[model samples]
Target chain A: MAWVLEDGRPIYAQLVERLQVQIVSGAYPPGGKLPSVRELAAVAAVNPNTMQKAFAELEKSGLIITQGTNGRVVTEDERLIRGSKRRLARRHADAYFAGMEGLGYTRAQAADFLRAAEGKGEAEDE
Target chain B: MNELIEIVGLTKAYDASHIAVNNVSLTLPRGKIIGLLGPNGSGKTTLIKMLNGLLTPTQGSIRIGGQPVGVETKAHVAYLPDRTYLSGNKKVTQILDFFCDFYADFSRERAVGMLQSLGVDPNARMGTLSKGTKEKVQLILVMSREADLYILDEPIAGVDPAARDYILRTILNNYDPNATVLISTHLIGDVEQVLDEVIFMRYGHLVLYTSVDNIRERHGKSVDAYFREVFAC
Candidate 1:
């Protein structure tokens, strides 16, 4: 995923969110070795110190673990991964609902819209 | 060991009317990519020159690694001036040789590798290359040195957007972790993400010096936005 960051938040906080999404979505597979702080910082075009800080935040939540000298890896725990995935999904859904509310759509209408869009997309694919 | 460069009450007065820098004091630790930011005529260049021992401070003192700025400190600092001082008649290879001869820490192989990657021809004359390419060559030369501190004055200002990214990447990937890189620039938005800390100057006075993330956290805006607010006319 593109590490597009906004202007209003801490860079490390943004990095933390991006890495969390990557881990949960299997872009960085469970048990997969994460790139070194320097490599990832170059890729993200951010300071390595900020990347290190983000990794520390992830390690605190058990989403990733740092080995003594071998570098860090995404958590291999299936349950932890699933929980993180669900939390991220819930956050997106909450944001969607809030946006739909601002557009004068009720929660039921929003759900129906999702159902309708999914069915229409399936029909078009067929 | 933590503090790589220290400045206390540093001031540079050109005359009674022109005070370029005034009573600035700060300590920069090693392993940080710090942004020296300010509007035009804010004494950013003057402060950098003083750090490089090119300009003597009228008041106060600067100690790099506990030693005053002189020959010893000069050997530890790699400076890239805002303007090009490389001779137009010299080929890229000759310039590389010059750096190798001048700085004991300069790595010719590393410079060559970087130049090849950037598709810069070593046989080409300095005057024949584009302004952006010249700046890239200068940056690569400076970065190839294994110095304790790198002072780059507006390294990215003369380059294009894509080249800016390359410069930032080069800075991120290169350099020793124990070395401190101090880059002075007005393009805050472009370099803010790459910077660990930033020192803001305003009309020869030190306005603020803080971590980049701290600015976003406290001001609820990016460093660029906050800078506009702080230095707005």
Candidate 2:
């Protein structure tokens, strides 16, 4: 839900990705109201117009919708959210495997690392 | 909501030999915060003065809201000069009164509210206040006006980092959504985030005028970093 942007990328694109995370992760609950452009821009410390652009992109992606006087709300479409989450996971996995390959690890070794990391997390839980 | 300000072949020279601003043409749309950025003595002040009608342009046309730079445009612009414009002897409250009397858009309530938040005493004499306090007072007066364009010059120059943060936040929060704010400063790092577009100048010639997002995406650098590389000596 927090917005942290690196310098080189377009800010609105980053904002769109961040908002997608918020919506798909249920931090902004389905059918819940979204903050005003000015409010969100202030929070992100970015120009309001830039935030507007991000919101427009999010709306276009079906993650958010405006309901007349109701302003903008997280889409009630559960399938859309689930689909977006899966897509993001796929993109991340692709990048992770690519990075691991660059570091001389095969896909099987990368999967083993993930399993080991998951086992370590369970151990910490105990 | 149309073009708020337009400059066509705008040029300025103190004498026939040396030009301070040279044949710069640009259009500023309504409701955007523009950063006029350049190094020292890059003619930022001269261009601002021409826009405010404080100084006459040598040649070319400058229009605001389709009108030439005259009383009408003057009334529509809220200008914060690089230095204190108010006489040092006047009390802060008296200066506020003067602004209210002169500009129809001036809101005494807004001025007072802004002053209170910045911890500026209205009753204090301008001459007696410290340098930073004076800048805050000037900001309060300028932002009080409901003008269509606000031209702020070196607003963060003299202040400390803490005060600079406050000034940037105030600028972001205060302006009406329809009013265009054009701020001229060399302190790119501090104001880069809030700026929608930036106008880069070098030796009085505009080198670039582009959106911050585009500069970030295309140049692969922060505005400050790009500025350093572009204007590197």
Candidate 3:
């Protein structure tokens, strides 16, 4: 999939978010080697330095580990991945509720709408 | 050694009445891609020409790798002007040969590879090629050099949207890690993501020099958006 980065935010931060989603979705499976900064930067058409900064952030959060000369790899810890997935889902839910609120729906009303949509199979899981 | 290019009180005057670049001082570090952005008649071209030693500065000084802008600096600086300067009568291979003979750092193999990939005919005269094709050839020659600094003026100006992506990627993958690349263009949105920092010029004066991310963080807008606000009429 093409990288979708929004304006008005730091590119490196957006790259970090994209990588997190990829890790949680098994697009970059646990223990898989990550592409080099130059390769990834070229693919995204962004500065390699910015891409490097994003990798450093991912390393700090323990989502990726550097193997010194062997390059970087996704963490092998399944629990950590699950935790990140849960956090991502919660963030999406929050955004959904916020949008619903902007449209004049209360929290309870938004929840009811979601349940009704699910019952009709209109909100199928990806 | 960290700062690859330094300008002190740089000024260029067209005559007694007009000043193109006015008392500008800047220090650019190595190993980064920087944008030199401004609107029309903002002196971006003047500053770039001075850096390449193509035009003389009326006052102040510019140093690349601690050497003043001169013949010595020219050898290490790969420059692509906004317009094509190659002779129209010459074949692409002849221009390639000229670059090979002129710049010791030029890579004939690399230029050939790029020309082949772009499907630019080397045996054809430069006059017969399309404007976009000519720009690609020029870019290939400039980027094939292993220089300390690369100054490109509106490198993406005439290219199509698809070719713009190719040009940006070429810059990203080719530049030496320790060298600095300074690109001057008014199309901020096209090159915003690739820039580490940007220098804004307005009315011959340096207005703002800051990181791309910093602009986004501080102003809650992209560099392109911020530029529009700052340069709005």
Candidate 4:
């Protein structure tokens, strides 16, 4: 997955978001090995210390764990994946509804939009 | 690994009574970029000179790669002094040849690439180049080496903002990861984001030596803001 950096936000926060998205999407499947700090820093074109800070933050949140010499690994805990997915879904719904309301759409109209979205999803699956 | 550069109770005095660098002890490890910061006449140059073996310390010792600062250490340390060190009559290609002959670690390809990218003609004499271009050439030479330690004093000083960024990027991209780089400059704000650690000097004394993260955590401010507060007149 591609990394996106939002303007004015701290780089570490963006890194955390990117990793979380990867974990929730199963890109970094359960027990997968994450890239080393030097590798990530080179890829991101950032300082190694900045990448280290991001890794430390991830470790603190229990999303990943590092083993000596073996490098960092994605945690296999299912609960973390479920929780992150729920949080992301809720945020998306909130933003969608807020935008619809700002554009003068009623609750009923928003529900209709969701039904239309379901139809499009089914069509794409078929 | 042992300290790549070590200074123990080091002091420097230009005159008999006036001290440039007070009693200071510091151990700088390899493979890290160190930012030596201070205001004007804060002994930053003197301290850097001692590290580069340009000036002998009045008291104490400086060891590089476990050996005392001498001809052996000098060979391993690439230094760019605060003031101009090259004569105007010499061409850029001549200096490059000189460095390659004198220092075993000088990389000719890297120097040529950097000079080309910087728009510095290799055949142009130092006297013919503009001040900013000259500074860029100096930086290119210093960073082209695969030395154990690289000491640069006021590398970006007197350059325009655009050239300053170019100089910083060159230093960042060119150096060997295992080499230690000590850059001494008063422009903290310009270089704070790239610094892993900072050494602040004041009135010939080491006022502070700490990581950028620790400083931010303690002061709730960026290193630039902390610097203004600490060095304000």
> Which candidate comes out best when scored by DockQ?
3
The clash count for each model shown is: 0, 0, 0, 0
Model 3 chain A: which ten-residue window has the lowest total lDDT? A117-126
Tens digit per residue, CA lDDT, model 4, B64-152: 99999889988899899888889899999999999899889899999999999887889999999999999889888988888899888
Best-first order by DockQ? 3, 1, 2, 4
- Pairs that collide, model 4: none
Candidate-wise lDDT, in order = 0.93, 0.88, 0.92, 0.82
Query: Per-residue lDDT tens digits of candidate 3, residues B1-233?
Result: 79999999999999978999999999999999999999999999999999998899999999999999898999999999998889999999999999999999999999999999999888999999988888888998999999999999999999998888888888998957889999998889989989999999999999999999999989989999999999999
B40-142 in candidate 2: lDDT tens per residue? 8788999999999989999999999999999999998999999877899899999988998999999999989888988888889999988988887888788
TM-score of each: 0.95, 0.92, 0.97, 0.75
- Report how far off residue A69 is in candidate 4 (Å): 12
Better of 1 and 4 by lDDT: 1
The better-scoring model by DockQ among 1 and 4 is: 1
The candidate with the higher TM-score, 2 or 4, is 2
lDDT value, residue B79 of candidate 3: 96
Give me the runs in candidate 2 sitting further than 4 Å from their true place: A1-4, A91-95, A121-126
User: Please, what are the lDDT tens digits per residue for candidate 1 over residues B1-233?
Assistant: 79999899998999989999999999999999999999999999999999999999999999998999999999999999999999999999999989999999999999999999999999999999999999999999999999999999999998999999889888988846799999999999999999999999998999999999999999999999999999889
